[model samples]
Target: MLLFVRTAEAGKYKQSPPDGIEPSTLRLTAARSNQLSYGGTSTFLSIIVQIAQYNLISPLQIPESRILVIGLDDAGKTTLTQRILQHMGQPSKTTIMSTVGLETYEFKDKIAKDKSTYKLFDLGGSGRFRSLWEVYASDATHIIIVIDSTDKGRIFVIRDEIQTMITKIKRANQKILVLANKSDLPNAVTHDKIVNACKFDGVLREFQIRGLNCSALQDTDIEAVVDFVKSK
Candidate 1:
């Protein structure tokens, strides 16, 4: 899950760091260039260009991993996906249309000597689209299943769907990250209450799915979900 990608100057270019140059050195060079470029001026521009020519050889880089986001409709999977993208500085055009089948976004991150890239699969979350999930389910390295924390009426259906889907996949190595989403809602179900109602504890024991409570709109809360997926 911890994919190590080397940072290259150009987009899509990848390579390992040179033997002598540490990643910190490369980051420092980039930071200096950014600082110099902050206040645009002819003199400052020329000086920064000269400094960049001498010290900065490439762009800042880091390593990243992939995760698949899935759940029932209106459970905020798409919103969460966009939030994660924004967190990685790759915000895209916002829209409210339903995902036809599957959508993907790549997040590139800089970490130490390596640049990591995470491919996030934001799959459609409606029951009618469940059939399409199997095609990509096997390909996902990690799975995040988001449940509407306030939807007490649909708990049984949600639980059944999760169990059935995992049963169909039957991949022992596939890591599952469950999100009790919509926690910020006034009537949102408590994490323990949801787990009990859905019998997730029993299902987790049987299927071994990892579950957590989070509000995707909150960056701090969502970070835990990101960390869990990346841990794979």
Candidate 2:
């Protein structure tokens, strides 16, 4: 849960916050909070709390992010999650599980002073569950689309899916973090090739997209992942 607490509320939020957002734009960071309750009794006392006033939520009452970690079934989405967690000193005891429908992992990147916890919604890449991507995309604040860099034949499939997805959603200002996983593999596709093939310049034109080469298993390019996620 992305909770925002202030000494005194300030700042105005948009009438409706976008499902996707850029951390730098909000300067969003989480803070450790403890819920406390106290009671006072008087001759005649009544307590009233103002939850909301004209949707003025102190620039909050907003979601930090619901990041959709999407890719093909074997695109290393699960491995990427575990590997990055290990680097963050939160190793997963259970081995990577093949996502049946969806698996969620919450992450608070360690690279920056930013304290928000990003929920990585690892949607199963199977064809059947691909449709669910749209259902979830509507609520996602950021989309981390993982690509299997070594699978040249299916790279087209991945590209087509991306093109299709972009068309089906409200993509303006959508913040996407594209990770080209398994780049350390033999004859892996180059970053340039992946971008062009994925049509990042075309269909994804309206998105605030950033791409990085990553070998999650080997921990290479891991910092880039941490940094971007914790951006702000």
Candidate 3:
């Protein structure tokens, strides 16, 4: 089975002075104290106090969001997944072979005072693995169904797979992100045609799903896909 894992590198936190504490006071204290002790004691105490204060006002961290990436074979799900990780500055070295079941990756992000985590499952795209998708389908908060935009002839086939997965999961409320991959090619099918062919009206009426054009082969286009995933 081919599985790709991308983990974001941990970011450094710049601890600011506690809300009411003056920077000048901290500087003066540091200046007066011996360099070695000041580095250890003052810094440690300041961090502890700041953390205690932050805890009192901050909300508990939300559990990481779980997402399932699924699509027809050769739809570029693995490549897209790798691109997503890269966009976050966490390029992974894991190479995905043909996935037999599923591959998992964890991502952690700290933006401002809030922390966000995500768990992504890159499910297999082979026909033999279709039966196994149902078992893991319900775990996904969001589903990304990648379609080869250039393979217009197979639109219905992709639609069938998506519908089957949705039916098995039986979660009408789960959000869906339709990635139109291979958009960089001249022969790629237009979004409108693909939607029409896939009979998206039923999905539109029943579920929360949005479509975006992407070319995972190109670095910039992958960023667009990442933004879409983050926005959802």
TM-score winner among the candidates? 2
TM-score of each: 0.64, 0.68, 0.66
Model 3, 137: alpha-carbon shift in Å?
2.6
Tens-place lDDT per residue, model 1, 101-201, is 45666556432222566777777766666654543455456778788888878877778877777666645466777788888878887667777887777
Candidate 1 — worst ten consecutive residues by lDDT sum?
46-55
> Number of backbone collisions per candidate, in order?
11, 2, 3
Provide the lDDT at 129 for model 1: 65
RMSD of each: 14.7, 11.9, 16.4
TM-score of 1: 0.64
Best-performing candidate as measured by lDDT: 2
Q: Which residue runs does candidate 2 get wrong by more than 4 Å?
A: 1-63, 89-91, 107-113
Question: lDDT tens string, model 3, 188-216?
Answer: 88666677778876754567777778887
**Model 2 residue 13 distance off true place after TM-score fit, in angstroms:** 35
> Residue 107 in model 1: shift from native, Å?
3.1
